[model samples]
Target: MLTLTHRDMLTLKHRDMLAFGHRDMLAFGHMAMLTLTHRDMLTLTQRDMLAFGHMAMLTLRHLDMLTLTHRDMLAFGHMDMLTRTGTC
Candidate 1:
């Protein structure tokens, strides 16, 4: 049996978010809405974690679309991970 850490799970979630392109935000939004609407099926903590991950992904995507500085992106990326893991 293999066990995954929370960091590993979050990494996979981030990878899924990165799999989409800028042109796919509309589709992503629709999918996210569907997922979020059914979030009642998840535990409160799970829902909160998912919401945080989605927000991080959206913010990163928005900044990318704006052609933000590499340093800014790096900072956001670091902050997102730390924030999500409650280490910030």
Candidate 2:
């Protein structure tokens, strides 16, 4: 079982934030502020969730997944519909 204290959670968040590029610095500051304010009340699950979301976002950004245009959105929507209908 992995147990994390508030300080550990903050450290992890900061480290992950810094792993990205300069474009994410603003978001890093925002996350740091939010974590500092809510550190005392944060549960391990909540921290894990936040970290997971950040990791996903970072992965998407790194893969240029956030550069989707309107056409890409439409295509993705179509794909989602197909998957939902078990047709893809």
lDDT of each: 0.24, 0.22
Among residues 3 or more apart in sequence or in different chains, the pairs in candidate 2 whose N, CA or C atoms overlap within 3 Å are none
Best by lDDT: 1
Cα lDDT of model 1 by residue, 1-88, tens digit: 1222233232222222222222222212111221222112221211122222232333322212222211121112311442333321
Report the lDDT tens digits of candidate 2 across residue range 1-88. 2333232233323212222222121122111222322112222211111222121112222212222111111111211221111211
Candidate 2's TM-score: 0.16
